[model samples]
Target chain A: MTGLLAYFVFFATIATIYAIIVMGLNIQWGFTGLFNAGVVGFYAIGAYACAILTGPARDTLIGGFGMPFLVGLAGAALAAALAGLVVALITLRLSEEYLAIATFGIGLTVQLVALNAAGLTGGANGLYGLPRPFWSLFDSVQAFNLFYLVFVVVIGLLVWALLARLVRSPWGRLLRAIREDDVAARSLGKNPVSVRVQSFVIGSAIMGTAGALYTGYVGFISPIDFIPILTFQIWAMLIVGGSGSLLGGVIGSFVIWLIWTGSGTLLSRLAPPDLQAQSSAVQVVLIGLIIVLTILIRPRGLIGEKSAVSSKK
Target chain B: MIQAIADGLSTGAIIALGAMGVTLVMGILRFTNFAHAEYLTWGAYMALAVLSVTGLDAGQTGPFRFGLGLVLATVIAVVLTVALALAIDYLVFRRLRGRVNHITLVFASFGVALIVRYSIHLIFGGAAHYYSNDLQIAWLIGDGLRVMPDQALVFALALLVSVVLFLFLKYSALGLAMRGVAENPALAAINGVHFRKILFWTWAIGGGLAAVSGVFYGMTVQIRPDMGFQLLLPIFAAAILGGIGNVVGALFGGFIVALIEAIALLWIPAGYKIAVPFVVLLLVLWLCPRGLFKGSSGGSK
Candidate 1:
């Protein structure tokens, strides 16, 4: 029973971290109408930044600053925001599909850099020994898991509260105005490009925070963690949860992560031993089908966008 | 350098075919079809299936190292892939045409791409498979440069088909109708061109072209389930680096991008070769958003 509880806590912690990432996506894609197909790229920057800042010395890699966890988190977010600003400034002029493709390319480039830059990223083996916060307070594995879960949940709530407030602010309305009709916003003297870039940077910082949180909990970072499939999974969660709603982002992460893990366990139990290895591939197919089905059945998502000022299409 | 150029040309030929199909869909549909590359994967698998059933893949050939069985399989692949493309359109994309915005359609296509790619993975189990297991030595053309007959055959076929395609677009009645529809759908519809027929024909031609490329690609390299998805970035770069919806431009874009990828290995580590297209894409997008080509033939003819 304790083991099961510990597992749930572990799962919830990861889901909460993903929830933070989803909220970041919501800010960019849902709020500002920026089609950022490179969520994992910014996430990766954050993870690597934090790992490099907070990790212990290693012979092969360039890390070993051994900084405080909070400082590492701040540096990670800053690094990601800087990357977002540069990328957005370069590619934000392209409309819709072009923008998506450009961002996806950026994501791939970042992943490639992480994979091949052995001296900096520790190569494909990944960086390890990143410090976790408040490790001294916990004695047993269960206690540590429970403590981490609370820590992540608190961070998730703080992020949610901040974003919820931001969406209701004037800046949020401007984002929607630009999204619904860019020309109208431009006519009203709003610099849509500047605003869009700002939102992208902020959203990227949030994703970076999530990545830092992930590194804190997992204590390891690898290039594989930043694959395009991670971008797909985040998009799926946001699509399933209402895109424009903060509550939906959190809920969707938990629900989708649950379905993802639950299906894995269920498949392991039901499938014969010969086919157990193939079940993960089946799970990917299932998630993909669910994405299609959700887009078809409920494009607005489960909770739906609860915008007060913006008119519906 | 000559060998690299030869390899680049052969790879570029396959990419040119794929990019042409993508440019077609982007022109007609007004959305980048992310799932278009999966048609190539399906086409390769279709050819593999035909060969396996007929025992033709094992058959021997002459100097070219290709057999009559492979040709028959390619023909069969074209038909099956065209059908698959049409079926997917009828089931998913047709419904999405006027209902949602283009971005929504793009996300839907992303979903479709994932489904198609992973379904192939589930069926094929992720192992790499080749059309011909026989290895042929490259004939020496120079001191260092050698050319494979298969590579020559693939490029020649690609060039021939591209010429035919260009002529068809320039002269044929259906091609004129397609151009009209791409330029202005409402105006084309008013002028007695059936929009649905044009859309169907677009997919048919695109799928058929993709099958040819897929077969050639499988001939050159091993076909894996993820091959289509991995190739997608380069294909997109080719289409965009050439102007979107411009056939001639996409052809040039393919060769340029491939040549760059081949040559970039001298400067960067081989593992970073995957990023060459992306760097080219970012540069092109930043400096020349309209592409290097002068024609912006989309929607205005």
Candidate 2:
């Protein structure tokens, strides 16, 4: 019973981390109508930042400043936000498709650097032994996991509240206006470019925070963790949940993670040893099918845009 | 240096084929199909299945791996890929058209790409397959430069196909209709140009060409599920750098991008070669958003 409880707690914690990412994506894609295809890049930057800052100092590489956990988290958010600023400045002027491609490129570049830049990123082997907050305070693994779950839940709630408030504000209204029609928004004395940049940075910062939390939970960082597929997964989740709604982001993240983990477990149990490796291929195909089906059935997503209905009535 | 150029041109040939298809689709459909690369993968794998089924993997002909069986398989693969492309359009793209915006289509393409890529992986098991495993000694031309006969074949075929496609597009009535639709779909529709037929033909041609490129790419490099998807960036870079809808621009863009990649190996480590297209894309997008060509319409306007 305890084992099952612990597993649920662990699962919930990871799901919450993803929820954080989904919410961030919601802000950029949903609220601002910015199509960021390279989400994993910012997530990777955040993970690396936190891992480097909080982990013990290394001898051969540039990272391992050994800062506190909060500092690492802050660094992660700042680094991702900075990267977002750079991407937004360069690609925002172009149309949505170009911006998507450019961002995808940026993500790929970041992954390449992580894989190849041995001196800075520790290369493919990646950095390990990232310090988890308050790990030493707890006696048992279960206690520590429970503590972490509660801690992450608190942060998730805080982010959710903050984003919910932001999305309802006048700033959020302007973002939607810009998203719907940029020229009209511009004509109305609103600078869509600056506002988009702001939203991109903030959303990226949130993704970075999720990365930091992920690193803390996993206790390791690697280039393999930040593949383009990660971006696809997040997009799938957002699409499944509904793009423009914060509530959808939260619910969608948890539900998708549940499906992901649940199916993974089921696949492992069902498939024999020879076919087990191919199960991941099946999982991805299923996810892809889900995405296509969702687009077909409910392009607006499960929860959809709450603001539109509320404002219409 | 000569070897690098040779390699660049050969690779550029394959990229050009893929880019031309992509550019054509972008011109007519008016969206960057993220799943375009998957057609290449499907073509390669479909050929692989044929090769395996026929037990012709061992066949070699004329100082190259261009066996008769593989040749036949390539034809079959082209038809199969074109059918798949048309089916995808009928099922997904056709339904979504005019209902959703282009960005939604883009995302849908992403989903489709994932489905195709992983479906290939599920079947093919992620192992790289070669059309011919035999290694051919490169002929030393001069100045210690070596060139493969296979590479020569790739270059020639690419050139042949490009010219044929160019001529077909220029002279054929359907080609003119395609160009009209690309330029202005609504206007073309008003003028009684069959928009749906043009779209189907464009995708068919694009898919068929992609199949050839995929087979050539598999022959030169190796066919993995991720092969075409990995090359997507380079293909897009080629298309955009050449100018989105311009076939000639795509052809040149392919060569330029490939040449840049091959030569950039001199300065940066080979591990960073993947980022070269990205950097080139950023530079192109920044410096000349219209691409290197003028009057080649159908971009993010």
Candidate 3:
């Protein structure tokens, strides 16, 4: 049916957006061994930035530049990269635990700001009517959705190619070297801090791009969309797929998203109407279980790391 | 200003109790237990569950809102929370110990936190619960300042527990073994210290303290599934500010963080109170990475 086709297109488009986010996480966490617990922060920045740039002019709200789609995307990435740079510079020198806590706090702080800063972020209601890329060209909703899906796929491929090239380059090797052992890399005259900063910024920018793409596709943006759970979901995707592998990150995104959406649908149909609200809690529990089981059983994940980055003590 | 200080002390007491477990786990386990906050939630909920079953949540004991029934429920909750912590360790963490990297453990803890928090959410509906609906008059302590008797009780009990814990760690053999392992795991193992025993006791004490804090928090504030999570940042800030491994420092840091948050309300909106701990945490991490305390044998390395 046309309905099924449309749903599939929508699902694939969202999944691809998540894949982009996962790939970004892979760069910071998988490649650089940086525990960025604040994926949502950069993500929120991107979404808000894009919404402000491309959205129609509003008297109450801040920016309504009505920029081109690509310009909005670029602005999102820049904003996210700036945030990533600040976070990395401050917390990268600390222990992994400290970095994790700091990032988590930062993520929460971003959410708080979004909730409070009414004029800028349109408060909790959030900015709506975001201009979708090439939306006006299509007559039907389905046609537009299909067109957007193709556009997203193309962007996804472009990102993949860019990341693939970067990882294969000398700079990518340096990231891996630093990840494996920062001291050894430092001894080899490689400045691990600067390299980590670069990776963090790039990864954050990619997350921003993903956020911008999500805003463009969904046609709305809100603070509620960038909760800590979003970060956790991306983490689950990366961990399940395989951290160090780009293919694994992409696969993990689809797999996890499928399971997440499938569980929701299944739960809605199966559970009684009264208990429907609690079903989300069940889904979260499942996510938590998957994370635990995967870490315990398959630390390397399903696809496993292509490189010989030692996970063992 | 006086009211703010009073509220800060009460909040600090709760944070200190919660941070105690975190700092200990970080010291001995060498990983931040993100799930530790869930213990507080579980503790509060467990107490509520017990009270609801017994229909003992209504009675008020003199000036305080909670009665002997709540106290009994708290004891039961402490035991249950300890069991929960140990069970989690046995099932998940114990298996992953030294097998994976510290970051992996941290991620696992995140998962664990989500599981525990949502499990509480699934069991208890999203609605907030209270131990007693009884109204108590706030005691006028100073000029234009009001302090609740429950706050005083919570502060006293938290201080009492902290002192007892400090003394226990200083004098007790098992506590000494735990400290030894925290300081130098290899050396302690070589010296015939039972690492497993220390780990067991660490969880026991941590869980027990967390339960008390949770109960105290529930007694003062409304009990919600997400209360533990809301408190997580402040607790971490306290622990880090005090120095990660130092128990006394965590206690001190908790009060300092709480006081700052409370006083900052004079300038900033109350909604921004959540950001206060994060700012303190950032400042501490930026300025004093080792924390305000000079020496703590455990996590400083």
Question: Which lDDT tens digits does candidate 2 get at residues B1-301?
Answer: 7778889999998999999999888877888888899999999999988988988763677777787889889999999999999988888988898887678888888889999999999998988888776888777787888888888898888788778877888899888888888888889899999878998898898999899999989888899999998889999999999888788888889999999999999889999998999999999988997789852555635
DockQ of each: 0.62, 0.79, 0.77
Q: What's the TM-score of each model vs. the native?
A: 0.96, 0.97, 0.97
How many Å off is the CA of B143 in candidate 2? 2.1
Per-residue accuracy of model 3 over B1-301 as CA lDDT, tens digit each? 8889999999999999998888888887788989999999999999999998988764677888777888899999999999999999999999988776668788889999999999999999889898887788998875878889899888887788778888888899987888888899999999999878888899999999899899989888889989999999999999999887788888888899999999998889877778999999999989998889843665933
Ranking by TM-score: 3, 2, 1
Summarize candidate 1's per-residue lDDT along B1-301 as a digit string, tens digits.
6777889998998898998888878877678888888999989988998998888763456768678888899899999999988998887788887887668778878888888888888877788998888888887885878888888888887778777877888799999998888887889999999988998889998999898888888888889888888788899989888887778778888899999998887777899887998888888978997778743357211
How far in Å is the alpha carbon of B83 misplaced in model 1? 1.7
Model 3 root-mean-square deviation: 1.6
**Model 2 Cα RMSD, Å?**
1.8
TM-score of chain A of each: 0.95, 0.95, 0.97
For candidate 1, the TM-score is 0.96
Per-candidate Cα RMSD to the true structure, in Å, reads 1.9, 1.8, 1.6
Worst 10 residues of 3 chain A by lDDT: A304-313
Sort by lDDT, best first: 3, 2, 1
Give the residue spans of candidate 3 off by over 4 A: A307-313
lDDT of 1 by residue, A1-313 (tens): 3777778888999999999999999999889877777789999999999999999887777877899999989999999999898888877766667777877777888898899898888878989777888887878667777888898889888888898899889999999988888999999999998998899999999999999999999898888788777887888889899888888888899888998899999999999998776777888887788778888888789887876666656
